[model samples]
Target: MRWSHAALNCGDLDTTEKFYTTWFGARRVNEFDLGDLRIVFLRLGDAYLELFGQARPPAGETPGGDGHPVAGTVRHIAFQTDDLDGFLRRIEGQAEITLGPLDFSAHIHGWRSVWLRDPDGVIVEVSEGYRDRA
Candidate 1:
């Protein structure tokens, strides 16, 4: 079966929506108010991300941490791009670049990637030449 969509529990829907749209070119396709929870669906090319927000504010810390994954962790959300350099330039000063725009050619043939953190500190990876590597 093919992949459908991924969901994220966001603290602020507007901020999260702007982040994805501004950097990754995601467009809001639909939204719903489900009594206790509110959700917005964003379409990025063929894929989708559902952003969920609760009526009550978050009680404690978010699910993931900065470095090193614990068991059963869903490390990061990755996106592929044709022009990595141009995308990097577009996002300058918009968010923090947490990790490399480094080369992965040694391990993955022609692959190169970079990592950035969203407003809520969720890791987002952007890569190029993944099809060749795959």
Candidate 2:
């Protein structure tokens, strides 16, 4: 079987929705209101992404919010780009540029790649030459 969907917790539902739509062409497919918070589900092609508010602790207990980096948990999500230069320029203002569109001659079969951090500090990769595999 194929992988179905994945999710990321977003602090701002609106901003998360807009980011996905603008950067990855994801369309909103569902929404849920939890009184204190909301969740938005977005889809792009066969992949799905869900954004939910951070969970709160029980009234009398402390929040179990971990103090580690989210990027360390799942590595990253990558996107294939036809125009790596233009894509980098477009996201320059929106996200934090972590790495370059440097040529990865060995690891990526001579493709160019760059890494960016999303609003929640999750790693996102933009790479060329992925289309060659298709």
Candidate 3:
């Protein structure tokens, strides 16, 4: 099967929407307001992120981390990029880059990754040259 989308709770829709759109080239495809909850769909190429507005960061989560993956809870989402350097340049001063531009060529051939925190402190990973080893 193929990937479709990931749903996340954001502190603010505007900031969350802007972050994905600007840094990841996502565009808003649909939105909804169900009285107390607000939602937005951001299409990034074939996959999209479903954002639910007004969520607070959990106390246990670090600003940029996997946050103790236990059971079925969602930890983070990773994206594959074509130009790692160019993507880094785009996020330079605009976003809070948590870590990397680290290489993992030894383990995964040409794999490399960088982490960034979303408005809600979700650690999102953007990488290039990642491949499955068989």
Candidate 4:
């Protein structure tokens, strides 16, 4: 089976949608409003990312805190790019680079990766040269 979309809880739907669209070239595919919550789906090629926003978040749960550095149910989300250098250049001063543009040549062939945080502190990993052994 192929992979599908990943969903995220966003504090601000507009900001989160803009972030994905501007940096990853994602386009809006669908949206839903359910009185107290809003959902938006964005497409990047076949893959999709879902954004969920709530008007009133449940107690003890902080909105837009999904990308915390600490370990949790989901630590981070990753994306692969063909032009790593160009992508980095595009995001300059726009997004926060939390970790490397490090080489993983020895461990994983020619893979190179960098990590960053989204608007809500969610860690995102971008890499290149990953060989899918499917």
Candidate 5:
């Protein structure tokens, strides 16, 4: 089986949508009003990333995080592509990379990743790995 879509709760749905659309190429496929707020569905490749304005925070306390796994947590969702550098150039205005295109050749032969954030402070990882795709 293959992985499907994921959701990220945003404080401002329009802002988050604009950021992802501009930087990551997400396309809007559906949207619905929920009386007090709204929900938007975006398509990114074969996956869907849903945005909910009135989404409740996860149970229990979250440190300084924006209070959701998708909002802020090292458990970030990643995307893999062959043209890592080109993709980085396209994301120029959206975020600043914090980590690497650092070589992992010593540990793993075909793994390189760059980390950055979305508008809601959600970390996103873009990686390139030849072996895995092979």
Candidate 6:
């Protein structure tokens, strides 16, 4: 099966939505509001993004603390780009580059990647010359 969307919990839905739409070119496809909760779906190329937010904690579970990036999970959600240099220029002074613009040519010929941290603390990888294999 092909990969789909990555869902994230947003403390502020509007900010999260704007971050993706502005920086990564994701567009809103659908949205829902259930009183204390909100969900927005966005599409980027063939992939989708699902964002959910809650006004308060549920009955038993505690709130996620400190707004820090979680580690040892998922690693990252990657996007392939045709122009890694041009993409880097576009995000300059606007988004935070957490890592890379480094070479991965050791693994794949002509491959390079850069990682950015989204507003919701998700690591997004933008790469060139990488593709799914059969």
**Which candidate should be chosen as best, given lDDT against the real structure?**
3
Candidate 6 local Cα displacement, residue 48, angstroms: 1.0
Q: Which ten residues in a row have the lowest lDDT in candidate 3?
A: 61-70
lDDT of 4 by residue, 106-130 (tens): 8778899888887765688899998
TM-score of each candidate structure, all chains considered together: 0.85, 0.76, 0.87, 0.83, 0.75, 0.80
Clashing residue pairs in candidate 5 are none
Q: Between candidates 1 and 2, which one is better according to lDDT? A: 1
Per-residue lDDT of candidate 6, residues 27-123 (tens digit): 9999998887899999998899999985342244221222225465566777888999999998898767877788878888889988887766667
| Candidate 3 residue-wise lDDT, 31-98, digit = tens | 99999999999998889899999777667746554333666766678889989999988788877777
**Candidate 2 lDDT for residue 41:** 81
Clashes of 2: 0
Q: Candidate 2, TM-score vs. the true structure?
A: 0.76
Clashing residue pairs in candidate 6 (N, C-alpha, C atoms within 3 angstroms): none
Better of 2 and 5 by lDDT: 5
lDDT of 5: 0.74
Per-residue lDDT tens digits for candidate 2, residues 19-98, read 87998788998889888878878888888888887643224422112212435466677778788888877877887777
User: Candidate 3 regions off by >4 Å?
Assistant: 63-71
- CA lDDT of each prediction against the hidden true structure: 0.81, 0.72, 0.84, 0.82, 0.74, 0.78
Ranking the candidates on lDDT from highest down gives 3, 4, 1, 6, 5, 2
Q: Candidate 5 residues 1-134, lDDT tens each? A: 97677888887788889977876788999999979979899898889888888655446653232224555455676777787889888887657665676767666677778877676666678888746433
Clashing pairs in model 3, backbone N/Cα/C closer than 3 A: none
